[model samples]
Target: MEGRIAAKAEQDGAVAAPRRAPSQQRSRERVERMLAAASALIAEQGSDAMRMGEVAERAGVSIGSLYQFFPDKRAIVWALAERRTAEGQACIAAALKDVGDAEGLRQAFSGLVDIYYGLFLAEPVMRDIWSGTQADKALRELELADSRANAEFLVAALKRLRPKADPAELEATALLVWQMGEAAMRLAISVDREEGDRLVAAYKRMALRELGDG
Candidate 1:
């Protein structure tokens, strides 16, 4: 009986120890710190200047721990882009929910432009990632994929608002609107608020005209 009890105890000990809940919390906190550090660094110095050691130092984590969460700066950049894309997509979707026709589309388009530009202004690092040429192949691919997805979403929204429109023409128009918005936002980053507002207003008018609402 003593031998059987000892064997059972050993078996229990051999089983994997259950992770303490605090351990998970600590891990999450560490990741958040690293991400925050990376964002600040990227924002101040651009993505090209980001280094693993700097990130680790800023994050207050060991280099090994940083690697445990992110393999490289590109991974951090990708994470940042993905997060912003999700936020921007949600904002656009919500703002356009009640929009059903050309006028509504105009309002939604302007709203989307404002939201997107606001997000970029709020996170300059995102603008760097979008316009930077120093990204890795995988990061570039991810960026392209994100842009394509956004274009598709815009096309779908436009089609819904203009059912009688040619699908190909609508897609082309959507791409034009997206490109114009991106370009205008890039220019707005270096300009004053009044100038940015004027540019956005002009683009909104042009987009409305393209949609046959003007």
Candidate 2:
């Protein structure tokens, strides 16, 4: 439910900044094509094996045009990750809108898990992208920042679900929920599809139990 998007800031030996963002409609469309091409390549081959030239060729844009939006492969991956994160957040926010109690939270969590499972299944390259963030310290910081944003969103949802709960405890609980949910999702995707569904169901029950849901 977290670990997406980045500020493209200088941190811990990572790139000092992101490439210039597309300013005009045509440039934006080209950037979209480049990112789309990169994603397709990453899905077909691991990110490490993908090349900028290949992406540009697949996108039908000049290599120079691709570089105009993403200076390197990492930038391409980062932008893709950012797009995925934004999508994940939107899904969670929409799910939360209908959640009103522990039972609602349980159902919403099940849906959330399903969404993530589908996301990973559909875009296998995201698994590698996530792993890369762990090996790179600066990307890990970006991930933490992304997680914090998601944590705040979780906290807001929890407040709506259990308004009588202590604010401090809710904050801590929200963080735990996010971490545990993320771990569960990773595990779920690592197993067979049917087994993954079972795992997600079990996690939903366990997580709801932790929140005092009967």
Candidate 3:
């Protein structure tokens, strides 16, 4: 994954802090359960409609326990966002690990898109977090910043694929690709299943062409 991307996000203050850090395995597990319950609520309703007490109840923890990890809905959302972003980065890293040619890159990109699409479809919380981020100014800014970090990761991968390419151009293209993928994802979810598959395929073609491939 893009190890530095998350670090850069933290450095830039895009991440929100939890009420307390999970220090022990048990604490971490408790916090995970709380977040999981919160995710279910956010997925069922919206983040604004999610209640802390209900989250604790669903998690089988006390209300105080929920507050021990997350202070508010915003903190829960941020943690979820961070988790999702990390998963996406891991997908990209795994997909590109064995890529050696344009065809390989295309396959890897396709895999990356498929993984993200599945994630969003399977987890309503992911969709909610993405939509929420776009609607909030501060979150929108953070999303854009994270996009850039993801782009830089892609730039590094592209350099491996095409070492002769111009550095500046590669950087620009990577950012464009990353943003395009995001847009495609938004559209994909809003449309029917078959159409969404076609849309994703089209995006793969465009991404490959922009990367100086098919």
- 47 Cα displacement, candidate 2 (Å): 0.2
Candidate order, TM-score descending: 2, 3, 1
Off by over 4 Å in 3: 1-16
TM-score of each: 0.76, 0.87, 0.86
Query: Who wins the lDDT comparison?
Result: 3
Give residue 172's lDDT in candidate 2 (0 to 100). Answer: 76
Q: How many residue pairs clash in each candidate?
A: 0, 0, 0
Write one digit per residue (lDDT tens) for candidate 2, span 1-214.
2222344344344643446877899988988888888888988898999998999999999988887777888878777776777777787778877677777777887778777877777777777777576676655666666566666777787888777888888777766776777667777877888998898888877777766531
Q: Comparing 1 and 3 by TM-score, which wins?
A: 3
**In candidate 1, where is summed lDDT lowest over 10 consecutive residues?**
13-22
* 90: Cα error in model 3, Å: 1.5
Model 3 — TM-score against the truth? 0.86
Off by over 4 Å in 2: 1-5
- Assess the local accuracy of residue 37 in candidate 3 as a C-alpha lDDT between 0 and 100: 89
